[model samples]
Target: MINVRSREFAVPFLQRLIQVDTCNPPGNEHKLSVLLQDVLRETGIASSIKSVEQGRSNLEAVITGPGSRKLMFCGHLDTVSPWTTAAGRYPPHGAVIEGNRMYGRGTSDMKSGLAAMLLAAASLHQDGIRLAGDLIFLATAGEEVDSCGARLYADQSSLAVLDGIVIGEPTGSRVAVGHKGALWLRISLFGRSAHGSMPQLGLNAVEGMMEVISLLHRHALEWQEHDPVLGSSSLSVNKITGGVQTNVVPDHCTIDVDIRTVPPLQHGPLRREIEARLQEIQQLHPDYRYQVEQLLDRGVVYTDPAQRLITTALEIAARQGGAGDAILQVQGVPYYTDGSVLHDNGRLPVLIYGPGDHRLAHQPDEWVDIDDYLASIDFYRELAIRFLGTAEE
Candidate 1:
């Protein structure tokens, strides 16, 4: 394995990673996975790549020692398309560094985190550092969309023995302990199509959707489940499609609703209530009918703030990120992460920490500050020494 002892490797590693277009619509993460496998091999870190689909792949490399519990470092490889951005319009894959920032799609949304994790593993091995437990490095595909890559790796029995998981998602390099879950639903409302010129001959599907949209708001208030860390649970109409032509009253309308949920809000009950509300709306409008379908439903997930892993990360980041004696604070984000899948399904304590700004995740000019990325390496190195160090027992 090629040992990556310095932070300088992060810039080049991330640049190469960004240059690979693993855009989610056609998620060709297998190419990036193959490339990382080759790069990690220089450090003698052998990896196994598993295909989630023909084109999607997840990779894992294990640095082992004495303990039974494992510490897993995970990052997803897929990213949203940035082809429309001005820079991306010319070359979406070029990793351009100007001053302190490196601009490219997925630079912040997590190629930087993946590079950090890979380098941390390689550096630890090169330093002859051995923990009592195993240090598992994972880079998964399809995180920007379906999260299929995470779910695929989480299914392995090898992961079930994990002590904790570190997801190097962009969090401004601060530690984030928890995040809200998401529920996506689609409602199809049916109406009679008639001539647009006809005054009362047709039921407008778009008009029906206005009622459906209104009812969704009222229904959301019924649950009223709120989480202190993640704040209030809320739902919104994200996508609406109705009407075919200007001269015709559309016969059908569809609305996609996105719900950000906190704890104590059961997906089953929330879904049931939504269907019941749609039924109520249908009954109210005898001329129209509707069907509600679940597009995606995942409940909330949170790692305890007091977990040893959490404390260790905070301490390492504080000292290495120049906080000195000050304690680094942890906050919750409103977005979901691969950590949620690892925590919820694999039953592991997971921490969301890494370089770059979360606000820049999918933006056109997304980039990670070189200085921030460098500081993050020191933090990750320390975190490994402390958390993985316990394996010496």
Candidate 2:
């Protein structure tokens, strides 16, 4: 059993993490990674910091054991931007505690989970517990935006050694077996600009883009494939911009599309379909010109419900009087996680289990129950022990 002081260590640690703002647009996650590294060092654990970019990095600490099997505890350091409004009502990085919940921007979406995993690893080291396999703690940058840290780590590290992974994404303490894939695209239309009065002289890019939007809307409605566990594959045009002035015929227009997909709907094929449609439009209108930029491409994550990692977690949850049957009922989240990039194409069994309600993620007044946060520490520690087993075993 982990020491009772583990709870005491986790709350303040989480509070400090929330206090440090690592918002995504300018994800200064290296700041939080340094803090985490120092905390691990104090517990006599050696960790390495890998730079992702200027002021962005990923942190990895490993507890080496005799066996080759490995288990990784992963969480992202970056969070969504805090609410622009309601700053006075709920300070973004305040880490304010009201009764059982700790209110902050990253508290639920999930700095608390990151803190819990870190402390859990530290507690194992502090208690001098040696496992039969390596236990890894990975804190990544840019999960809320690009997943650059995870991609860098995946490209550089030897992932074949890992047998399983636990992603501390807020699941409200329930275990999630998978999540939807993401395919974000930015489509830009270009044409000749001219005065609005002589619209015939210029090819209107905004008008062309409107046609593209209509095509996309029709496709979204027509293509309806559903995954029983992950729900439906869907598309939405989240953002669009064009035109300098109302009087001028716009020369450029761009639309950002957010596409969430499930099984059987691969990103490559879907992307090519959009490109093929653009070609058709060009064929119809000789002057039509466009460019499609893939902003992000993350594969879907799906692990078998029968995987040892998940079964063991469910067993532990039941034994600990956790979510019980709710935790046992396997499901997948709609939002993508670092697991999407790190899962090695569903080869690795990644269990998404952590404190905080999934609904609270990215919402204003985000919070994680203090009790849930503390409980997750024990859950992580116990799962590591049971899955890896002690050296004596």
Report each candidate's C-alpha RMSD, comma-separated, in the order given.
Answer: 2.2, 2.0
Candidate 2 C-alpha RMSD relative to the actual structure: 2.0
lDDT of 1 by residue, 290-349 (tens): 888888766576878799999998877777657753338777777788876777563577
Off by over 4 Å in 1: 1-3, 83-91, 222-225, 322-327, 344-346, 390-393
TM-score leader: 2
* Model 2, residue pairs in steric clash: none
Residue 170 displacement (Å), model 1? 1.0
Worst 10 residues of 2 by lDDT: 1-10
